[model samples]
Target: MSAIALRGPERVVIHQHRRALWSAGALALMGVAVVVAAWLWASSASDTFAGSGCSVENTVRGCGDTVRAFLDTELRFSRAVDYAGLAMMVLPACVGMFVAGPLVGRELESGTYQTSWSQSVSPARWLAARLAVPAVLTLAGVSVLSAFSAWAWSRAKGTYYPRGDWYEREVYGAMGTAPVGYALCVLALGALAGLLLRRTVAAMVVTVLAYVPLVMVLNRVREDLWPTARFLGGDRPGGDAWPVDSGMLTASGRAIRLKDCSGGAGDTAACMRDRGGVTAFADYHPASHFWPLQLVETGILLALAALAVALAFRVLRRRHG
Candidate 1:
């Protein structure tokens, strides 16, 4: 008897690709439209600044109320862009759930993977195909969106309005190579969860529940990943510093919260001195540290993603080998 021809994982890839084409295309169009709108808005804001002779370098100088109102309008619009960009930052988490749930979980739960296994497709190859296609697409799409977001943010941040800052959590997630790393990590996480749970609803729930804590931990630890600089005896060093911690140093060399000395007897400075405070200090990351922080965070997230992917393959091999 002749043996049946087996295309193995190719069939799985092709099937999934066809299913995702329209959704992926729609997402891509939406991303492009958002970026174009931000760029145009930024351009118009720039023209407003130029017309008023009020560059970021000289925003302090008097510009008429008309110019100020226009600039304020621009700031408000930039805040809207910020909201959209932040939503994009969480796109990976959404992708991760989809990957784990309907993509892999449903197949496993419904015993469809068995059909593929019955063919010449090894469990490992099937799982690999499941992970790779969506991963590639997610990486490409998220990276472009992150770059566009960063560009628009840079243009808007130069305004005199205080509506945004780099250290803001959502802004940080939206701005750099970090979002790419995040997307990859979540996709792997979703894949692993699906493989372990082997149930569509459970895997979907686990992915959603797990992603929030993971993001929170990352944010809490991010500023500490690199050594922060201590600024002493000054107002903040400059415009582009992220103040992580601030306090007054006691004469006995203990640090006390800045607020501890506020609203005390006599003047604030005198009150601080009486409380054994000798100097003020701030531990912070300067604007120059932006890329360093971003690269370090990206490295950490990608490492986590690699670990998740490795474990997922191991789990598949153990379960099916």
Candidate 2:
């Protein structure tokens, strides 16, 4: 039949991916640079710790003045990583926005998609190539950043550089496999948004707006993914434990928040007792739960990404078929 075409999706992918590949190459190089920098900084920080003769047994409070200074010095590197880590955390969203706008949106905006369709590249295959090239690149770049971020944080886990608890949103987003998840999800969503919006700037804006809230929502619900260990009484959990909620349980079995147990007069403990606060308990996740939380979130994000990709395909089929 004359309806049959000459060029396949392979050529369509190659043509669509040339400039995208260049950008991906640039991002890959930047990821490599970040990894090298993180390794060097970690090595220096390790040396600083070794020079101070501080072992894992030495808590932050237990360190001597010399050791404290060394830790502070080590923290400079951690702080750098922290700042860079925020960017890495957001990088996937940024990449998705770019993919949505110039990469995917421009073709739709400028009618180049018709050229591809005319060349025997079906809309589905063209869209698949449009999404796939950037997906691979997004994974590569963000995976490197995620690995380095995880390593850097691991190097500083017991230290004070993290500035807050391990469950902190920024810290959690950058470390582990979560960033890769964010990247893939964002990219897929970007593709779907671009396909729906059919305008470059609009697609970019929509992708970004959609991405930020998803991240925040995931962060908020992440702790609930698995059961946290419950601690009661004066027995403190290990320093690596991240407390999700802490409160006082009254003799009446009512939960009183820790903030509400302020002892105004003399002994705080006595005042707490007077307020019917019998025992205090905390729910926390230990360091061992890091991967579990990370992987669970990753799984959720990946599923969302798959859904978005499927939606993109459906939209393409409906629009072009």
How high is each candidate's TM-score? Answer: 0.81, 0.78
Give one digit per residue, the lDDT tens place, for model 1 in 1-321: 001332557455656556565586687677667656755775676676677765544555476565666666676657756766767767878888988998789999999889888887789888887887778777887887888777767766665553467878877888788888888888899999999999998998898888888889989999998899988885766787899877778877787766776765667666766778788888899888888999999998899999999999999989999
Model 2 over residues 1-321: C-alpha lDDT tens digits?
011332565445556556766775686567557645755765666677777656655556656665656666666666766776778777878878977887788889999788878876678888877776667667776787777677666765655554445677877788788888888999998999899999999999999999889977887788899889888886668777987877777888786666665655576566667778889888889989989998999999999999999999999889877
* C-alpha root-mean-square deviation, each candidate: 5.6, 6.1
User: Could you tell me the TM-score of candidate 2?
Assistant: 0.78
Residue 278, candidate 1: C-alpha displacement in angstroms: 2.0
Ten consecutive residues with minimal summed lDDT in candidate 2?
1-10
Stretches of model 1 off by over 4 angstroms after superposition: 1-11, 41-76, 159-163, 250-275
Q: Which stretches of candidate 2 lie over 4 Å from their true place?
A: 1-7, 14-17, 31-76, 156-165, 250-276
Score candidate 1 by TM-score against the native: 0.81
